[model samples]
Each structure stands twice: as structure tokens, then as C-alpha cells.
Target: MSAPSRPADWDPRASQVLADPIAAYDHMRRTCPVAHSDYLHHSVFRHADVMGIVLDHHTYGNAASRHLSVPNGMDPPEHTAWRRMIEPYFDGARVAAFAPACREIAAALVGALPQQAPVELMSALAHPFAVQVQCAFMGWPQALHQPLLQWVQARNAATLSADPRALAAVATGFDSTIRHLLQERRDAGNAAPDDITTALLRETIHGRPLAEEEIVSILRNWTVGELGSIASSVGIIAWYLAAHPALQSRLRRKPTLLRAANDEILRIHAPLTCNRRVPTRDVTLGGRHIAAGERLTLVWAAANRDEAVFGDPDECRLDRDPALNLLYGAGIHACPGAALARLELEAVIAALLAATASIEPAGSRPTPAVYPAGGHRQVELLLRPAAGS
Candidate 1:
């Protein structure tokens, strides 16, 4: 292909798609599922198209960014090695063991919030819920929350060119933190209940102990992926529940609803819009030819809303089959921490619902989620006590 052809009318760089992208995703799925963008270097929007590339790892190599996602961007054998090193950290048993800690963190954070109304859900709830759990998992000190939060916020801002300096600060802090963690773990001989840091320090890569650079990449991926994605996702869930008080009450009444609620949230508000892939060679998908080195956008948000795969694609019904949701992503790059993320979300939601009588919109600041993804990210709300609730 000489140059990727974009749909004539749409401007991929426009902010509206990043403001409330579901409409755009809906449009793309129906009109140009296998569409390309002249500016975007050939993006893929349909569910099947993205899935084909994601599942067939050989044809579409990952390795997009070397620093943060390490193996998330790599292909098979190399990918498999890194994946194996961290797999034990995300296993069923690992999640099972983490349940208690997750619940404790949730209950503590929820219980500690002042009874004052109009709490900014980001600072008061979502941020804490995500950070505390991550800290607990990594065996890091809770005192690190403030600076860590700042670093993460700065990093996200940098990604959007919202704040270049902020991004630099985040990187510096992150690098320092990684160095400290590695040194601390090494000094302690890296014994663990089996978290990623512990697993890495003890394990070897390619028959050699992992170097500092490799370890830094692993930590960078963890911090970047966890901080924004989890925080943004938590805010999304809370905003949804806060709007639908009935659903909030339902979760409060039945703790078991936590898991399904998580699934529903993932389907409803997929925060990560499009993940990129580089075509290995000439490949035809949905009548579109993808040449080598062309960038393909895997519209995860679009796929979840696909009418062919999901009925009432625009609705947020919690009763849908959880397995069908592609919110975490698909194929090799599908989230390994999805189980852990769900557990954390479930615990926090259950606790918040159980404690508050009802959630009301105190106030929510409107900010667009990242693209080729969109939605409101910051939502402020009041958790009013339900009568006899």
C-alpha cells in the first residue's frame, strides 16, 4: 500500500473522539470495521480484525515500546520467556491468596473517608483503591502514596502532552522507586508471598539473572499500566454505580455481585481504547491489505461494542456473560492482571456500596478519556447514607 487511506470525513486527531468515543466506535464498527487512517498509519477497528492480529502473534509482532511493556510489545519465544517469569504472580492461586489483603485495603480506605459529602471520587476513592492494593501487592510502604500518585498523574499527563515536565518528574520518581525496590528486595534476599518484584528478583531470564535495565522495564510497565488504567477504570465504575444507585444498592446487598459488576464495568467503560500492532508482512484483513511495519490500531473499546458479538451494545446491563467481554483485551497481549484488577474492583465496590446508603452526584469534573478512546474520567460524587441502609 502506498499510504493508508483514511475515511474521508473523519479527522483522527480531532478531540471529540477522545471526549466521548463510543459514538465514533459505533460509527467505525458499522461503517469501516477494517478501515485505515492516512494519519494513523493504518488503524484497525473491527473486533475480528483486531482479534486475528492479536491471536496470531507471529504475523503481527508486538514490541511497540521497549521501556514500559517489555514483553507486552514482544513476540512469541521472547514474549513467552518474559511472560513465564511473571505468570506465577497472576495465577488463580495468587489472586486467591490476595483476596484477604484486597478486602482489608478496601474496607480500610472506605471506612477512613470523612463523612463529609461531595468527595472528589478520584482522590477519595478510585486513586486510593488502586494505589493501596498495588502497594500491598508489591510489599511497598503505604507512605509512598502521595508522591507515587503525583508521579503517576504526571506520567499520564505527559502521555497526552498535557504536561511534559510532569512526565519527566514521574519518570525520575519511578526510576528511583524501582531502584529502591530492587535494592530492598535484594537486601532482604527477596523472599516473598510471591509478588512480581519478588518473583523477578529470584528468577533468571535466558539462563541469567535479570539485569537492572530489564528489571526497570518490568517495573516501568507495572507502574504505568497499573496507575492510570486501574485508577481510570475505578473512576469509571464508581461513576456508573453512583449514577445507577439501584445497581450500587444491589452490590451492597450481595457481595457476590462484585465479580459480575466488575465484568459489567469493563464492558461498559473500557478505558484503554486502542492498542497498537505492527504487521509482520503483507496481510489481508476485512478486505484491507496491511503492509509490513504498518501500524494497526486494535480498537478494544470498539470490539466490546460490536453488535455482532454483543446485543444492546450501548446498554450497561450487568447480567451479560462475563467471558464475552473483551475489555481487558484479547489474545497474547490480553491483560494478565485482569483477575487481580477484578478482585480489587469487586472488593472496593462492595465496600463502598455496603458503607454508603446511596451514591449521589455531588459534582463530577468533565475530562475526556484518552484516544482512540473516549469518556468522562473525573467524576465527583456524594455517598449519602441510605435510610436504614
Candidate 2:
């Protein structure tokens, strides 16, 4: 056996790719489904190939990160155990319980939007809504919202920079913030509120109590998912609707169709771009031979928009099979918080549509986000509130 050659198929961080990742990924899926680069190492862009990697965990390991990531970065049976414990949090009962709070948060934000004027949706609505919902869900103090938002920005910057030292520092900062909250709950003891954070304190693994680090890791993952994907998703869905008046009008009229409509819109413009996986054994995919131990980046943004699977990648059809969309990913490592994410997104979008008569792009065009981040950096829209209430 010989080691496969590592050639630069394309520069993932190139200016053109960063400028518009959705278009860049579309090109990659067609031209080089499986390409190699120094930055991402091996990038997988096709639908079927990515499905194969995620489904078969034995050949594709999830322990890509050196730090602990609970179930997300862990392989079974460890991953399985963590996943089981975490699933209950997003169970039907819990999700239903939080629906009222989520809707209230969404409604309040939408109501505050400037009517018939230019407003940056990300800052005014998306980011605040994301952080507020997360904080409410976890029973965290409202005071943490600003700090949490700041942390998300710093973490995203560190990831994009690809500086190992900077990434570590950012991780430590997040851990510290989480640790303080945990300590506060501990200090309060019986007086602490019976919330999710407090509930985690009572959980155990394999007959032993979970370590402080483990609890922090679990919450960190949830925080990142809520803050990043949920916020980005809001921007993408709103931006798409603003651009397409017909679809926007359709969702507003139907209202019940917001969930499927959201999934379809995000499919067209992904909120989270990629996820990492390492090969436990040598494998050949999409006509490219990848060596064992080499890192592979599953370009979800590309896979979800694959022409082979979606017919026309750009077309938005709510009736398309939901199984094909990789917005929350697939297989064992699929997003555990997907239910909660859907609830949050649906609440926000529904509120926006209900509160607004129309939403259209305002002043300058949206500034697209770069690698490691999807959706827009800044999305400005002029909103018109619905008649009466």
C-alpha cells in the first residue's frame, strides 16, 4: 500500500471562495467533489459521498478535535451515552414547554424593529433573538447575553484565523464563563433554581458523576449551536424571503408553512458551512484517494445544494423530501438540538411574518460571511408591519 498524494485541488480560503461560499461550493461540487487543500486537507462536496462518511462512523471518526466536545466530537459508545443523556433535553415535552418563551422572545424582537426603515437584521434581530432564546432556554441570567454574544464573535474570529494558540485561548475563555455559572449554582445549593443548568448538575455517567469539564463541554456545544447556527439561519431565511417576494408572501399567508419554508431556504443558503471528520482507514471517494489519518471537511453547504440530489440547487421547493436536506446533518452525529433549533427558527420566522406586511432589502446590499461562517455578516432590511395587531 502507498500513501495517496496530497495535491492542492483548490484554496478554500481564497478571496473568491470567501466572497461567496454558496457559489464557490456549487462550483466545487461540480468540478471537484473530493478535492485536497492545505487548509482543509481533504474536502468532500458531493451529497452521496458526505452521506456515506457520516453514516459509517467506523471508517470515519468524529474525534477530530483535541478538546472534549461531548457527543459531537466523540465516537460511540461514549458518544452514544452522551447522546442518550442529551436527547431528553430536546424531547417533545421540553421543547413544548419552551415554545411559549421562544415565541415571546421572537415577538418582542420583531415588534421592536423599525417599521418602513433600514435596519441591520443581524444585529437588531437575529443575534439578539438567538442569545435571548438560548439564555431563556438554559435559565441563565439576562446579564450574560452581551458577554455571550461577544464570545461568539471572538470564537468565530479565532476559527477563521486558523491560529491554534488563538483558538485555545478562545476555548479557555468560554470554559471560564461557563465554569463561573456552574460555580454560582453550586454555591446556591438547594436555593439554586431548578433549571437545565441545575438539572445537569444531577446527571451522572457510568455510575460516576460527570466532571466539571464534561458539563462545561456539553453546555458549550449547545451555546455554540444556538448562537451560531440559529442566528445565521434567521439571517439567511429573512434575507432569502426579502429577495423573493412571492415566497415571502406565500409564507406570510400560509404561516403554517414556515417550518418547511425555513428548511428549504436554508438549504439554498446554508448557515453552517462544514463539519470535520478523520479517516480511520484509507478510503477512495468521488474518484479521489484519501490516505488514513488525513482530515476531511464535509462541505455541508455544498452537499445540501448538490445538483444531483436537489435537481436544481437554486430552486426552493418546500415539498422536496426532508430526508435529503443536511441542514441539521445526518447519521449518529446528527444535531441533537435540531428540534429546539427548528422551534426557535420557526418561532422567529413566524413572528416576523405575522408582525410584518413586507420585508425587503434596504440601502446597501448584505455583506456575505466568510469561511467557518455561513449566511450574511450584515443583513439590512426595510420592514412594513402588518395592519392592526
How high is the CA lDDT of each candidate model? Answer: 0.74, 0.90
- Please give, for residues 65-138, the per-residue lDDT of candidate 2 as tens digits: 88878878999889988888889998999999999999999999998888978999998999999999999999
lDDT of 1 by residue, 294-319 (tens): 77777778887777767777576767
- RMSD (Cα, Å) of model 1: 3.0
Give stretches of model 2 more than 4 Å off: 1-5, 156-166
Q: Each candidate: how many clashes?
A: 5, 0
How many backbone clashes are present in model 2?
0
lDDT of 1 at 13: 61
RMSD of each: 3.0, 1.9
Worst 10 residues of 1 by lDDT: 368-377
- Estimated TM-score per prediction? 0.89, 0.96
Question: In model 2, where is the ten-residue run with the lowest total lDDT?
Answer: 363-372
RMSD of 2: 1.9
